[model samples]
Structure formats: C-alpha cells, structure tokens
Target: MEIRLAGIKEFSVADGPGIRTVIFTQGCKNRCKGCHNISTWDLNGGYIQEINSLISYIDSICPNKKVTISGGEPLIQYNELKYLLKVLYKKNIIYAYIQATI
Candidate 1:
C-alpha cells in the first residue's frame, strides 16, 4: 500500500512524549479555522510514498522513539495508517495519533 503525506518530521518533542517521528499525512475534512496546515487539506496533494519504504525509513532513522501520526488528518487514511501501525507494533515501536475534533 501507499501513503500520501504532506511531510515527515524526523524529530519532534512537542508532538508527544519524548522525541518522535511525526508523519504528517495529507488530506483532511475538518478545515478548521486558522489551521496551520491548510495546504495539506487537499486529498490529491502531497507526494505518494510506498508504505514499506516509509516503514524502513522510520526504522532506520527513528529507532527506539515514538512515532506520531498527525495530519491534515491521519484517520482520513485509516487503512494505510492501520498497516503502518501493525508494522510499528511488530517492531515494538510506540506510536500516537492526533486529530482535530469539532
């Protein structure tokens, strides 16, 4: 499977506890006012990335750290997110996700 993402933050302390690799998935329906990542709201925006390659990249660069899947809206790509979560689970990597609610 493939994932569309606005970008990836290799290291972030504000996203969650400890340093984390933040996967900023593309697309969102919320369209919250003053949203900082408004550009990520387009479903067809951002570049496509292979899921396996993403996992490998994270494994190599973000080992022993939490992986935070933020967005645009991570849940918008739930299937791919689930797969990514499963892979992370097998690797014993901790993860968290954030979403906007209204």
Candidate 2:
C-alpha cells in the first residue's frame, strides 16, 4: 500500500520518551487553528511511500529507539497504519505511539 507521507523526522524529544523516529503522515481534514503541521493539511501534497519501504526505513532506524507516528492525522490512512503498527508490534525492538488529532 502506498501512503502519503509529509516527512520523516529522526531523533525527536518532545514526541515521546527517548529518541524516536516520527512519521508525519499527510492528509488531515481537521484543520485545527493551532496545528503545528499546517503544511501537511493538503491530502494531495507529500510523497507517496510504499508500505514495504516505510517498514524497511523504520527497521533500519530501530537502533534502540522508539517509533512515534504523528501527522496531519494517521487515522486517515487507517488500514495501512494498522498494518504498519502490527508489524512494529511484532518486532518488539521499537516502541510505537500514534498521536491522533481527534
């Protein structure tokens, strides 16, 4: 599955406990006034990444670091996100957190 990604930010402190890889997904309808990621609001914007590639990138970065998923809204890609979470859950190498705007 191809997912719309705003960007990948590595080694963030405020996102979660310890160093984390943050996946900022694209497409958010919420349009909150105080949204930090206002640039990712457009669903048409951002790179389209395949599920496998995303997994590989996350795996490669799983060097004792957690994986935090944030975005315009990850639940917009619910099915794909679910799959990715499942895989991450199985690895047990990276902790995962999904920050929902809702």
Among the numbered candidates, top lDDT falls to 2
At residue 47, candidate 2 shows an lDDT of: 87
Candidate 2's C-alpha runs over 4 A off are none
Tens-place lDDT per residue, model 1, 1-102, is 999999999878888888889989999899888899999999999999999999889988895558888888888888999899998889877755565453
In TM-score terms, which candidate is top? 2
> What TM-score do all the candidates reach, one by one?
0.92, 0.93
Cα lDDT of model 2 overall? 0.87
lDDT tens digits, residue span 1-102, model 2? 888999998878889898888999998999898888899899999989998888888889767758999998999999989888887778774668889869
Candidate 2 — worst ten consecutive residues by lDDT sum? Answer: 87-96
> How many clashing residue pairs are found in candidate 2?
0
Clashes of each: 0, 0
